[model samples]
Target: MEAAGCSYQFRIALLGDAGVGKTSLLRCYVTGAQGAAEPDPEPTVGVEFYSRALQLPAGLRVKLQLWDTAGQECFRCITRSFYRNMVGVLLVFDVTNRESFEHIQAWHQEVVSTQGPDKVVFLLVGHKCDLSTRCVSSQEAEELAASLGMGFMETSAKSNCNVDLAFNTVTSAIEQALQQGDI
Candidate 1:
């Protein structure tokens, strides 16, 4: 169902390598509960969706259509098709997995090449922040985020830390960019 009074709808996608916690983050944000009912979520197939109505403090109401895309290489073809109309993308990576972090650039390039003129906003996210052993440091992620010309956030969907802030920050950025004709 559509949000009763939403004036805007933003289509956002979570892009990253497999097992980077995209679905967990989506579930946690939309359901306001733990990231998953099971401890280990079977990776998303092609693309899954979740929706939530957001009420910004500025009185802007929006319906967020969140897409959880499969990060496995085999499903890349399937996921790429959904990027066309996306207004924002959360480039996620598991902090404990260096390969996933390294793959972010390719994922980002795909979005840049596939989605044109829509001026989609991008955010680099370091997921699984609750884990103590991280192969990707905050400094490293920050620098990458800066180089990408986007914001960076570290969130733990499992612990519900910074999850809301991450989504809110990107959503608000998209809204601002749209209002200013930047996107």
Candidate 2:
């Protein structure tokens, strides 16, 4: 669906294990970009939708339909149902949580199995860079991203670091892929 004055609208989702900071990251990106007050992180029940209008440096205006998916196993069916229209996925993992990082491939498999690798653009996001108890190193994350053929980024919703960049880069990649008739 097109929004007034928006050039394009893409449905993007954030997926990972529970407590991986997907909701917090989406909240920070939307509110921070809008100049609104940043709120504390909260657990998502099922799925939540947030919209942000972004103007890319390349002059395309995009309205991102950000879907903050519940990472719990119980919500798998609910989240899976929304995958049809999705154009991008932010495969987020908490840097402090080893299991979340380890499960990155499974998360990617789930998405690609549902959407197909060519249908969607992906970005691996290692979140919670503000935390001192880092379990996943930047190099490890970068290496995994390289192996998966997707870009990697580290973000901290608490400190408001790289939240917008993560989303923008993924959107731009999707835009480019779409332009090249890859998606």
Candidate 3:
């Protein structure tokens, strides 16, 4: 197949406050299944990498290196170093946790400052939409994205809602930027 020879590798980082479902999102997208049905996710101590091959809109095969980072305050230094290597970033926030959503700006700034303004494609994702009790209004999420110059979507890793779409959308944006020589 033509796609077999058209391989490209892109690195993507998942950033947000701890417990914002960054690892859950990565597990869902990479494995096509939701994570264990547990009340709390074990915190990621450092960085974890997952790989998946996706066919782009133009039949180009792209290998995505999805990096899930430790969102705890102590890991900031370690996690910040990985930002420069990322072509795109999924800045995830928990829909139920207002603080997580509010912290998206810090994540956005970290990625932009590390990757440079012109090279990074960012997607603002409000995660955990499956939990109705914690839902943050979509309007708020959209406004944050608009303010930060990023695309926005609400996703539920538990329900598999918009999980794939978020990743694919960011990848497509990155591909388009590359085609235009913008990144």
Off by over 4 Å in 2: 33-40
Candidate 3 lDDT over 25-128, as tens digits, reads 99989888875463566899889988888888798888888999999999999998888768999999999999888788988887777778878999999998
Worst 10 residues of 2 by lDDT: 33-42
Q: Tell me the tens digit of each residue's lDDT in model 1 across 72-122.
A: 999999999999889999999999999999999999999999986358999
| Runs of candidate 3 exceeding 4 Å displacement | 1-6, 36-40
User: What is the per-residue lDDT of model 2 for residues 3-93, given as tens digits with 9 covering 90 to 100?
Assistant: 5788889999999999988988887887774213555557788889999888878888889999999999999999988888899999999
Give the alpha-carbon lDDT of every model.
Answer: 0.92, 0.89, 0.88
Name the TM-score of candidate 2: 0.93
TM per candidate: 0.96, 0.93, 0.93
Best-matching candidate per TM-score: 1
Candidate 2 displacement at residue 21 in angstroms:
0.8
Q: Where does candidate 1 stray beyond 4 Å?
A: none
RMSD of 3: 2.2
When summed lDDT is taken over every stretch of 10 residues in candidate 1, the lowest stretch is 31-40
How are the candidates ranked when ordered by TM-score, highest leading? 1, 3, 2
lDDT of model 2 at position 58: 86
